[model samples]
Target: MEVLRIILTQSSANYKKEETILNKMTYPLPPFSTVIGAIHGACGYKEYHKMDISIQGKYDAMHKEPYRDYCFLNSIGEGDRGTLVKLNNKNFLSTGFDKVAEAKKQQGSSFREGTTIQVMNQELLTEYRELKDLLDRIKDFEENRVDKVLKLIKKRKKDLADKKKKVKENKEALNVVLIREKQIKELEKNINDRIKAYKVNEYEIPYSNFAILTTSLKYYEVLNNIELIIHIKSDKETLMDIKDNIYNLKSIGRSEDFVDIKDASIVEVVDTIDGPITSEYSAYIDYNLIKNECVFLKLGDKITANGTKYYINKDYVIEDNKRIFNKKKVVYTSEYVAEEGSENLHFDISSEKSYIVNFN
Candidate 1:
């Protein structure tokens, strides 16, 4: 089979695990999607394309390094509960109609997560009209949705009564009055928020206590001076396109980890490669596997993206609008056998299991 061999070298890189949240970790080999994403990045394609990809790489644990993680919490009405944290700065959240355009222009321009909270605050104010409108809405709800406010007001009154009971009868009334005032203010604010929500909720309440962006010291196991070999199995036209602009392809793993592309040539797949585990290959979407506890390797998986590690679980079909790739097979080893097979092959190695796939 004719194939386009693309050689890429990276000095330092980390393929983040899919489940990583807090601490960033690194995978030895790039995932199937990551490779395609990088290629698509260079090609500047709008949508995903269908193409067979073969990836094999050798990397060593260079060292553990720290990186800043950015997360975002969506506004109210979108959902309830915990905020959504983005491991990487995909885009900066901005406020105001003017800043919305500015934000779009600056999207992907910087890897850093900017002042999202500030932007959101600006958005909520909306020329201060929203605040006035919300106040008016709260009053309207008091007359309309009287039941909703009654329960809330009654709760506040009950709490106040309890507080008064706790205080000595002879104590100064000023403190009690101050407490009452504070409670009333809080009650009104809550009512305002609840009523505004009824009228098509707008901005998410960015309470400093609930919404938070924390920075902590974390480390990622960086793969230093690694080389990856990607075989592009596509038609002559696609091959020519890649050959022409292969150099334009950027880093495969992390953006900072630049890939040194070399040896772009047409080649043929040889026989089945039988070898011991010298290095690990990425588990792409294909190579089907059944749902069960399958012991593949002694080591766990690395996801430096959010600094987390998790083993593969369940079987899923890898497909988008443009492509339907392989159905991954379960394996007993950490590495995948990257060889051309006439038919899908599976075998057992003593107590271990392996799956080899062939793509025509």
Candidate 2:
């Protein structure tokens, strides 16, 4: 069978494991789904394409990198804490926010009173304080004036209903009372609409520009000098597209994990071989292949070598507006051997290349 063989390299990368939180952990290699997604992205395919991949790679070293994590609060309350920021755009959290001030003391530091706080940007601080004052005024108006008017309207409606009951004996006068009650209801609705417009424009819209954000230090596990050998098995058209746009494959693990394409070619490979072939690089081997003895793990005096079992993600289908991934169960190891007449293992037949392909 002819398969697309790609050799790639990255200076630094973090193929993050999904379960990790504070310290973003990195996988031994990029998962199956990551490689597939990267390939589709490079080709600029809008939809998922059917393909199977074999990922094997090595990294020079591993290290922990530090970064700051920011968590923004949904709404500010009395005695607010954390760093105060003025958002460049309303109602969206992006890199477009300017730091107005931060609490010098973690607790009991007031952003509004400017107590024990450092003002980074005086203009933004003034803007934030003005917005806060406007919000307070809006709240006071709603409670003292708008709400009182609504209560008076309700009481007037009740009084009209009482007057209608008293004039029940006179049909014409009762009809007039009902008409006046209807007019009062219409006036109340207009007042409510006006109040809503006032609050949305004066309070909610302006308040969205200011946010209280908290920060924490976190670390990421980064792999350095990554070398990856990927094999792609798909239709002829898709393979040709990838080969044509091989250089467009930018990153695999993260946006910062930029890739450099070394080689891209079609190579003939055979599932059955006449002699033993051992893996030269660490690879994700199908667990079923290991279970059936198609691939053996033996090195030096160790007859039974063990490897880390990973349920690596491959493809995914969107169900209920969320992606449900198809995971492949594989064993990650460098010490794997494939002997004569193997079912799942493949040996590259290229005269200049020697590779043991274990597609999971």
TM-scores for all candidates: the values are: 0.49, 0.84
Worst 10 residues of 1 by lDDT: 95-104
Residue pairs of candidate 2 with colliding backbone atoms: none
Error of 2 at 39 (Å): 2.4
State the lDDT of candidate 1 residue by residue for 51-100, as single tens digits. 76655556655788886664444432211222222222223343212221
**Steric collisions counted per model:** 18, 0
**Cα lDDT of model 2 by residue, 91-197, tens digit:** 56875888889888867887788898999998888877887798788789889998999999999999999999899999999999989999999999999898888
- Which one is best on lDDT? 2
Candidate 1, residue 348: Cα displacement in angstroms equals 25
